[model samples]
Target: MGRIAVIGAGMGAMAAAARLAVAGHRVVVYERAATYGGAVRRFERDGFTFDTGPGLLPLPAVYRDLFVKTGKEPLEACVELVQVDPSSRHVFAEGTEVDLPNASRAGVVTALDEALGAGAGARWGDFLVRAREAWDRTRRPLLEEPLWPNWSVLAEREPYPSVPHKKLLRTRRATTLAEVGAWELRDPRLTALLESHALAHGLDPRVAPASAAVLPYMEHAFGTWYVRGGIRELARAVYERCVARRVEFVFGAEVTGIVEKDGRATGVELADGEVADADFVVAGVAPGALDTLVPGTALRGGDEIAPQRGAPSRLTVLLALRGGRPEGVAHRTVVHAADRTEELDRLFGERPGFSSSPTVTVSRPDDPALAPGAEHEAVTLSVTVPSGLSVSEADVEGVLGVAERAIPGLRDRLLWHEVRTPADFAEETAADGGAVPAPALAAADGGLLHASNTTRMPGLFVVGGWAHPGGGLPHAGMSGALVSGLIVEGPQFRGSQ
Candidate 1:
């Protein structure tokens, strides 16, 4: 077995480390931070705890298989995973509310019908059927398999199977996600629901390809979940698993550069002027950091899809409230912006800020572990904001004004709040412009896809949110699997076994 050098102890890096160590390799992880769990960091103050990144887990099966493959215990045996009932509650403009149940197709349809009115449920359900086709068409190629050599085929092709519509004498098919909402769903509230899914991932719905509909379909299919304490617990479990496999970890050890010899990666240079040599090197840092790691070595593929940079990130407000979470409150509630057009324009356009009425996702997990007792509650409000801009108290106040709809008298129930912004993300994950990476989206000539795990450099590879398959928890987990498979199986490796 050979030695491997893993950079940044993020989820992806750790996932790969555990697997490679179990495969009889000496894997050492170097994290710049003093502790593990990169962006999956947790916050604790006044006996209240909150997850600063990725509050919920989707498509957990990816992690499940990982634990089973590497050890005798499954993921559930290590971490407390609880399914979030009423997957989400959407509070749309025009005072419409819909509570979509956990992984129940009929329940979602019924909820939509009750909230959006007659035929709305059937329409949304039918749209999901089409979205299912898109999921099936791209799942194997996009998620399960590595970025193929003929990746341009996925770029040039749109696998959404959009429904055709007739406007006047001409016939057209929905090409963009916005078109899918306006032409197919055809309701203002439903449009908001559909667009919100894309917006949550920092993708502008107006321009996001119709294939993006798969985003919502994924949530509806897999359901949302919460760890008993916080989502960060999942990261802790993975880290422990890596430790159990004897993967060496050196915290606060900043890797300054990759030592290359004869066009192949041979080791990494530490900021302290020390060098750690390895047979293979894996990087989990942002694109900018990756460049700094191994200067003059190009990692971008021939497909022209640069790793997404300066993308929108999240603004999280951790609130400690004076009262307990009431029964029947959904775990998650999306308070839709009153005017989405203006919101999108402000965040993605030249404004370099968020809308006065921005969409806010409020998470109120009923887990007692988060609060000191039943007398108080811990709440988190997340809003998608421009990565390059700075957020102010006024911007957060605007969000709370809308959030009042979900939790009436939110101001009265107020407790002190702590804010986490893109600047914080920059320090935590070294992401460029404080932008958080989204999952690798299909379409647009593969313009949004991430670089392959196996880079042009012979002994260097990329993994984590910044790598192939892209940013969300499950996607990042999958990226680790792909990198490990490639390193272990050699150049002929196609995908995970």
Candidate 2:
């Protein structure tokens, strides 16, 4: 059994370490922060708790699989999941409300037809079927495999490798959702609605792949679920599982360098100059930060390996409000501006900042543990902003103003508010530029967006949001699982070495 060093105490690193430990490897997780769950952590102030990152917990099956692989059941440790009805409530500029239900495709289509117009539901049904096919084709092959630097090995040896490689390259060069939606849906509102969901992943629908339309299909098929407590409870549960697995966790141990010998990583040197030796190293941090840890050798030819840029970071505002629940609003709400297209273009193309109409998601309604009382509510308002926008005190007030307009009685009911900009995310999570990595397939050159596979150094592997399968809690966890599985299979058998 080999000793392994996993960098970053995020969900990916924890999951990888747990799996590696179960495989008989001695695993040590070195985290820069004082706690676990890098981005999935929470903060408390004045008796109110706010999740620092990732508010929603979709794809519970993924977590269940991870727990089961480690001889634990997720439900045994965490609260049962409750599916949110009216999966999402979208408020358009014309005051038209689209309440998406968590139901079958036919039922959803019927709801859309009733909510929108004649024939609209049928078109959505056709679109969903196509999306489902794309999802089915790509889910296992591409998403389950590690985005390795050496593709030739898999192409020549692995099962169904050619299909996945072709699918990824095709997806890399596919048209954006905006273009496809324009062709499929006659109603601009419907088109925007479809594209908006894609944008939630920090991708611009105009440039994101058409396959992203699969997101809706998955949400409806699997149903949008929320943990009984806040999403942070899931992270805490995972952390607990790590402890139970006998995985060594060294918090506040920021990795400064990846020690190398004969061009192979042997261990990691902490920011405080302490060295922890191991046979393998797995990084859960962003690819951009690799240069700091491993220097030039770490990202050698990285630019060519995965030539994609990251998506814009976000300006997320968490509001603790004091008021009764608003009528006509569901657990999740997305308020679109009168000129959403122009607003998005301006946000992404020009100055990156919050718009007049930003997307807002209100969760934890059924779960009273998050708010602590029935009279109080917690709402998270998220907007795609520039990669590194700074938030001043004035920005907080401005955001609250926008939130008030989007949701009635919002400003008057506020108990307090906390604002987190891209800069805040960087400081809190150590993610470079506060960017949430996504698939960088927007370029005509077929490069990915945020997903990178630049690992060239021996004994070193990159996993999680910054690498393949892109960002998203489930995909990041799967990335780690894929890497662990590869490591278990023997690096000599894998071409990534």
lDDT of 2 by residue, 90-187 (tens): 77667777778875677778878888887988888877777777666556544665544543332232121111113444642235577667666668
lDDT per residue (tens digit) for residues 1-497 in model 1: 99999999999999899989989999999999998988999999988999999999999999998898789999999999999999999998888888999999999999898888999999899999999999999898789898888888888788898889999999999989999999999998899999999999999988888999899999988989898899899999999999999999999999999999999999899999999999999999898899888777457655545666668988999999999999999999999998998999998886667798989999999899998889999999999999856888898888888889999978998888999989998899999767888787778778678888877789999999877888899988898888888899988888865
Clashing pairs in 2: 438-450, 439-449, 440-448, 440-449
RMSD per candidate (Å) reads 1.0, 5.2
Q: Which residue window of length 10 is worst by lDDT in model 1?
A: 297-306
* Candidate number with greatest lDDT: 1
Which model scores highest in TM-score? 1
Question: What TM-score quantifies how close candidate 2 is to the native fold?
Answer: 0.89
lDDT (C-alpha, whole model) for all candidates: 0.89, 0.70
True lDDT of residue 308, candidate 2:
37
Candidate 1's displacement at residue 69, Å, is: 1.1
**By TM-score, how accurate is candidate 1?**
0.99
